[model samples]
Target chain A: MTREGINQLVEEHVPKLVETITTHIETLTAPQRLKEAMLYSINAGGKRIRPLLLIATAGSYGSVTNAAYKLGAAVEMVHTYSLIHDDLPSMDDDDIRRGKLTNHKVYGEAMAILAGDALLTESFSLITDISEQDLAPRDALFLSSRLSEASGALGMVGGQVDDLAAENCSLTLDELESIHRRKTGALLAFAVEAGGLVGTSPKEDLTHLRKFAEEIGVAFQIKDDILDVEGDESAIGKPIGSDVDNKKSTYPSLLSITEAKRKLRNHIEAAENALKSLSVPAPALFSVLSYIELRDR
Target chain B: MTREGINQLVEEHVPKLVETITTHIETLTAPQRLKEAMLYSINAGGKRIRPLLLIATAGSYGSVTNAAYKLGAAVEMVHTYSLIHDDLPSMDDDDIRRGKLTNHKVYGEAMAILAGDALLTESFSLITDISEQDLAPRDALFLSSRLSEASGALGMVGGQVDDLAAENCSLTLDELESIHRRKTGALLAFAVEAGGLVGTSPKEDLTHLRKFAEEIGVAFQIKDDILDVEGDESAIGKPIGSDVDNKKSTYPSLLSITEAKRKLRNHIEAAENALKSLSVPAPALFSVLSYIELRDR
Candidate 1:
């Protein structure tokens, strides 16, 4: 498929994915304030790259099913919750995200915390809901298990802890990569593997998909670092140089911007090579890889 | 079973439950500080009431399986996570919990929040681990779904939002009950219902168990209110009259202490009556009810 074809596919499916997520949050019987806070973050104009990637990969295997949408929304919810908490006063202390006021800036800190907590809790509930329908119980179980592993202590949260600890201190490239692998890469990799699971791809194929995701995951972060140094602040939707202001290590800080860009390109190539091992053509997946490589935000 | 027998049962099982929970936390490959913060709260003395209730109820139906212990630990983790977040400076800002420094006090606010997040995320992973063993995947899914409902926006977090909003305001008895039912009662109810699920109890029995749990859950909160009004700070493991200090509504604030105690007894009786509808006698469950009524802390 051409880039326009993939763009059209994303355009068609992204709205549906948003609807799925909004409907889930809208139908919640939670308190109005809590629900509003949750919806605010959910509708905060994210790129929806994670969920769309999951759906695109799943479509490569078979027809996109409700389970794909549900799981996609679930992963997005986790991503959004992490963003919410990451922006908290105690964490990143960011005032803006996705070009809007952060959750705590609108909702009080307590409500924002609860909103993040509720989103995280409800993401699993959303996954389990899939088991009642198109997905098998074991598959749902597998998804939830892997998701928790990817997002939990040994994964995203653990990486955040290390990142915080490493602030104002130099980190070896190996240490930085270790942090990013768990911090950001795990969830992205899970999205790819989830699509593979939905596709009932062979174990060998799942391994390759994981490798593909890991490379892009690192590339995604490298691009962010590069953007932090030189990309347009308005385009990125947050202030540039915040990483340097915070005195944190980044790809461009550890290596020059040129080297970082080169590293990013290498990762993209590695990801493409991993896709070559797949049993079937993955044009949609390839397009997603390009989108990740090119996205300004 | 006699009271001694019940005490012995709790004695035998509480240590095992603690071990189960600690083992899960210890096994994490997370960063050291994150794991330390998590283990600090997990090691802090808790009554193990929720998990014990789950185990005892499961025992009443049949031999408690590994699934029971796993689910019990999972619920405890959720309960512990809530406590960790609740004590945050952005939330209740309490410096002490369970006779020790609150997690944030020891680990800093960011680490505390991450610890809570890790625990909550790991709880579902722990549940999924059960699916690999003695519990059916469908059953594991059911427990996880119910757990999220009990703890998420519509339940614990929602109730917490209301509870925070209601602070310094006079709440009607009905409003107080509504808040406590979701805040404290929902998870307690889930513990009992989880027991039934683990026992593979019939649907009717599950309903009865839920009713029983709901009643006692309210009673548990009432006891907490009463204790807040007129209990030992050391025994309760926190400052006394904190609800009054915070101007928060409580059973004793809404009604006289005499009346609140009377209400507590009524709920306990209702809980006992619900248990009577079970197909088999639940001596262990009955003992738990008695423990709830008589406990000083």
Candidate 2:
């Protein structure tokens, strides 16, 4: 698939993936208002990077079963859940996310927390539903384990704690790398590797795919930090410079923009090189790499 | 085992179960404060009811193994995490829980939220660890599904949202039942059912255990409502009449105190009957029923 073809596939699948999520959550016996609150944020939609990557990676290897879309949506839900909780007054305390009101802003704090909790819980249930049909239970268990690990304290939650602790404190480039690697890199890498896991990719291919994911994942966060300094505000959507306002140490803050871009380029190059190690052409996967390199600028 | 024997078993096992939780959480690569927040709350130690019930239930069926203790600790972690979040300023906002400062009070709100998130994620991972050891993958998946359902939107979280929503509103008996049935009942029921799930109890036995759980689970909540109105404040520990102060509806408020006791008695009778249906003697499980009835009087 060409770059346009890959983008087209992503575009086509994201809505269906969201619909899959809405449909599953609808079956929950929760209150109507709680369901509405959950759906409100989910329906807002965002980059859809995680789901699209999982699908595209699986597609590249001819293992894009129908189950892939649901899994992709599940990953997105987990991401959204983290964002909702992260935006609470107690956490990041952001008023806006992705250019709209944060969950607590529209739904109130209690609902926002519950909505996030509901989403996280339902993400796992969605996997089980798929396993009941297309995927094996053991395979679903594998995905669940990976998802939990990447999002757990040792991963994104840990990074958030570190990030919060480092606020207003100058961080070395290594400290910056360490925090972002857990905070952002874990889930992004999981998105790629989840596709491999679901597709039952060979061990060698899985390792290469994971390397590709780690490199690009770090690159993606660095790009966000770089964009906070240099990218067009409208193109990026949400407010930038909040990091600066909060005195958060970022890529551009720790290293010169030129040096940060150098790091980003290195990660992107590493990602591209890792992709080449895969036996298959993986055109869609390559498109993913290019998209990350080009995003926000 | 006699009731004293069961009491001795609980006394013997609670420390081991809590130790298991502490050891597992100590291994997390999260920031120090987050781990501290988690341990502080887990160390506070409530009744150890959930894990003890799980172990006791499994034990009665001759399926209690060392792995069961770890699984019990995981359930306790989930319970502890919920309490941490529930006591947040955004939620219940209580200062003290289990006779200590709540997680947010001790670790600050940010670490508290992250700690709760970490505990929730680790709970599932802990189960997966047990599955990797003694359980079949499918069996672990089954347990995970049940746990997520009981704690998810349709379960505890949903109940909490409803409880929050109904704060200023009047509630019917059915409405109050709906709330607590989801809020407190689900996790309690899950403790009993989880033991059966991991033990591979026969379908008929599972049904009886579930019935027993549901009856006693609701009974437990009704007893809480009763204690709030009439039990000794010092023994109950937390300040009482906060429910009435909050003007929240309760069993005694909705139905008279006498009627509430009548309802409790009926449920307890039903629970006792359900226990007899299990093919196993379930002496420890019976003692659990007696303990709930006797506590906080």
Candidate 3:
């Protein structure tokens, strides 16, 4: 599949996933105002990169089951919750996100906090919904457990802690890499592994999936850093150099853009090799890898 | 078991549950600052009312097991996370809890938010740890699902939203009741039901437990309302007139203190009747109900 093909696939899956997310979230008896706050953020456009990654891998296993949408929604909720919390005045203090007012700016900090929390709690319930012919309750439990691990202190939260601690401080390249791997890489790993877990991928195939996830995860982070340095702010829906405002270290800061791009290419190549090692033909996964490499924003 | 016996039970279990929570949270690679923030809140004493309810229910059924501590800890984590978030400036805006500086006040807002997230996420993982015992992974999933339900927008968050929305606005008694039922009652219900769930209590006993939880939950809220109006500020670890400062409606505010006491007694009687119906003798649960009625803070 071509890179454009993957982009198209992502476009298709994103709306579907959003629809599912909206529907599931609406089922909760939250107050009208809180629901409105949550929906405002949920409708805000993200590339749905995490869900897209899960779907691509699931498709490769011929396992595009309904449960995948539920899982996809769960991951998306987790991602959305992090974004909401990160945008708080006490965190990034960003007033705008996704080309619009940030959650805290529009909803107020208290509501924004609650909205983020709602999304996180809702994510767990959504994962438990992954029960049917294709998935058992135990399978749902495993998925939920893995999601928890990825998002918790050992994964995304831990990484964020490290990232915050590194602010305005010079960090060794290895430390920077460790932070990226934990903060962003953990979720990416979960996204890739989720597909296989739901599809019941063989152990070997799961290993390949993990390899693919690790390489692309680092590449994705590097690209994000590169974009922060040079991408169009409007297209990115955030300021290009807000990383500078945070005084946080980034890939481009640690290594020149040229050097970061070189490292990015290295990880992309590793991803390609991992994709090739998959027992099943995974053109969709390959397309996703290419998209990560070539995406400008 | 008498009231003293129940007190002994709480004393014995609270530390063990806190120990379990500490051990599991330590396993996360979260930054030291974030971990400190979380531990600070988790260590704050809130009477550990929720976990005690669960242990009491389990004990009465002769169903006490190693897994009870894990479940108790998970409930405690959930309770702690809510307390942390609720105390945030955006939420209840309390600066102190348990007569100590609140999490955000001490750790700053970002760390407090992340700490809450970590505690909540780690909770699901702790439940999954129940897998190696007599319980199945499915049971863990069920417990997690229920906890999410209790804590999510539909439960605690939803109630909070309503509570916040009601602030500085006139509220009917029914509206006030709904808010309490969702905010505090949902978690209390979850705690009571959890004991029966992990112990696999008989269906009739589970029904009775739900009934008991419902009555006592309302009674607990009423008691809290009474304390808010009349509680010793230092003993309560918060300002006595906070609800008044927020211009919020309360049971004592709507019903006179005497009327509120009447309502409280009605619920306590209902809880006693429910406990009487249970297949197992639940002296500890009865003691808890009585304590709720008699306590000043």
**CA lDDT of every candidate:** 0.89, 0.84, 0.86
Provide TM-scores for the models. 0.98, 0.97, 0.98
lDDT of model 1 at residue B173?
Answer: 89
lDDT tens digits, residues B1-297, model 2? 245755786787887898889899898777888888889888886887788889888887776776688779878988888898899898888987655778888889888888888888888888877746678778778888888898889898999999998997999888989999899889988899888866667788988898988998889988989999998877766788989998899999989999999999999889989888988888878888877776773
Higher-DockQ candidate among 1 and 3? Answer: 1
Task: Give me the runs in candidate 2 sitting further than 4 Å from their true place.
Answer: A1-6, B1-6
Which sequence of candidate numbers ranks them by DockQ, best first?
1, 3, 2
On DockQ, who's better, 2 or 3? 3
Candidate 1 iRMSD in angstroms = 0.6
Docking quality category of candidate 3 according to DockQ thresholds: high
How well does candidate 1 score on lDDT at residue B243?
91
* Ordering by lDDT: 1, 3, 2
Chain A TM-score (model 1): 0.97
* Candidate 1 docking band: high
Residue A22's lDDT within candidate 3 is 93
lDDT of 2 at A193: 81
User: What stretches of model 3 exceed 4 Å from their correct place?
Assistant: none
RMSD of each candidate relative to the true structure: 1.4, 1.7, 1.3
lDDT of 3 at B246: 88
Error of model 3, residue B39, in angstroms = 1.0
